[model samples]
Target: KTTTTSHPASISSTTRGLSAPTASHTRPTGPTGPSEPDPGPGSPFFFLWASPDNPYESESTTTSPPGMVVDNRIFEVLLSLPIWLMVYFCHSNVLDLYRKMPKSHKWAFPWLIHLAMGLAAVVSIVFGYARTHHIAPQDVTGNAFVGLNIISNSERIGLLIFAVVALGKIPETIRSLRSLVGRIAMEVMDIESIMDTTEILEVIASPMLLASATIIALTIRDLAKITDLLGSSSGVLLSLVLPGLVYAAIYSTPYLDIKDHDKRWNGHRLGGFSIATFGVGLGTIGFLATVFSW
Candidate 1:
């Protein structure tokens, strides 16, 4: 009998009806290890590089109508509003930076910074829309192939630059986050008397605990869903609701001798109350939508 051999790609195509380089494709044996197929969602090592299925996609089936698609998109945008507001207005780093700036530098510098930030955000949105305008939302899930196929080299470079800028901010961001956390802890625990102890714990324990929790969260399969849930709920409260309430309370307070500001039912007071009311409705709907959709 004549010996016969088949190419791996041909064998896989014929036998499994799948193309080569799929998750089913086995690694070539090397000195380091035995041959194994690529790690998939079910693999023990999947968490390391796994991009979970789109939670929104799973909320609707492939047969969903155009109306349902529109509805889903609306809900997504609504939920995202809170997160965008959070980042733009009430982000810990931004607030911290504003607090540290001198009175002279505050007005002009902040206005310029915000102008640049707003322009950058608008440009990013436009760029993303231009690139992925042709792709269906359903088709744009977090799969690696989707990103690789859609993002051209120029777009990739832009993304890399943005990533670098983000990375550069990490140190300042960490300090801001730590300070915020310490302040919150102090307020909640009423630890004013034990200030030195609180400071020690905040310095020593907080980072380690936060890092550990972050690592644990990364290992979760549905991290995106959790993130959305958080963004819709706590993010809304912090960014929109609290700011509005605090503003109104400060202005409307009868006892406090707030200088250079009127403590009356003025436009500022009305605006603050309006924002708080809007936030209440937005947060409730967003949170409900996220939970129900998930």
Candidate 2:
């Protein structure tokens, strides 16, 4: 009876040692526990990632949608088109003025002034376009765009010099035009000066004719949107297609006789080649950009 009444020693020891579990022991807690801290003003990640602040985490977590960056860049690039057209118009007008000068005056020191003036107009247009289009120096990512901008800037400087020289020659040009006009009028009144006056008039008219043609072409192509058709083909078509076509037509015309005998090619031919090269290069760059872009 005494042996049977004795309690098991193991069970008694385990019950005696055990105590109620504490909060720290029952659950392993975080350093700050389960409570969230209030957000501060300076934390970007807090605003971007946290709940309650921006409940739409699905939308907020997303990056810019596809093509958005490319679309923005293309928009900026295309915005420069009108400004470039303006520059082309100004340059064409200046060229017309230069063409009107007498052949004797073509290589004269004063002709440099006309060249400078034309260049200035071009430079102003380019820089203005760049500024308006937000094509800042910092925006150029690599050698290509940077090179183009540099070339543009150099052209501007060259144009400034040409314009200053041309301005100085303006007085000379006016005097020449007036003298030629008076001589022609005198010849018209007297049949004797007819041949001489005709020759003089021809000299005076050559540059004017060329200048006028150039300006007209510029107006038609750049101002009138003749180039817009080609734009659908490629972005470079904006700069190359219409101008090339117009110049090609001019070179082919019998009236202009722009082609040099010895060279067997015309200014239009050269211009076309140059423009084609530019268009090809631009296309290549655009293709690369499209391919490598994220």
Candidate 3:
């Protein structure tokens, strides 16, 4: 029998070949330590109303993110509109035609838009004094005014916009809508025809002052949590005087049988009063929740 002895070079080559296969076959180790997840758009609190089952959260890449900040947060947490409104008006091409119109009409649509914005800003400001600890009229005692959510001065501008640039054009808007829907062709209403200066002076402004006085009294202890609820507080107070006006106007409409109408108007006023009452209740609940959260 002829015995063959393996050379050291051949043995080393065989060992190297074996090691290569072993190295390639084994699984690679993943990153060490605790796994970190992506915080996602905006920040950790970006997705309020998060749903685990919602595919959109994981799959969809681009969408308007939910906000924790006041700028992106829904108005009083009831509805989201302001940010979208600002974005669309600022960047959208739908208003291109409006932009190209003659100087007078060019600003007509924009003026209406600005008025609505001003009203919303005013509502936010008036309510800010109530809901926010940082914005109270005068810090009385304790840490009641020192809230968890501290808004900056830039954010504070929302409070100031509406007070100066009010619309006072609710009547105009209603008539415009009626004409647009009811009539086949809408006529361009003149400035005088659109504005009821009489109602602005008589019907709206007086009660607005009254509502302001009442809300100021109520906001003494920061009980205005859901600010948007109080947005219509003034209107509700205004509505309180409307039924009496309806009663007064019934005599003028001689042909129409307004005995039932009078009862209906009474109910309408009661409904408005109830709504105003409920708004107060909501504001109180929200305030308690903010101050006394577990």
Task: Pick the TM-score winner.
Answer: 1
| Model 3: ten consecutive residues of lowest lDDT | 17-26
- 2 against 3, candidate with superior TM-score: 2
Residues 180-293, model 2: lDDT tens digits: 334334433544445675568668876775585467455654321322211212333323433443344334433323335335335545665565466456445433433332
What count of clashes does model 2 give? 13
lDDT of 1 by residue, 134-201 (tens): 11233222212322443578887875686466444444444444454454444436566556865786
Model 2 earns a TM-score of 0.24
Best by lDDT: 1
Candidate 1 yields a Cα-based lDDT of: 0.39
Give per-candidate clash totals.
0, 13, 0
lDDT of 1 at 255: 27
Which regions of candidate 2 deviate over 4 angstroms? 1-233, 253-268
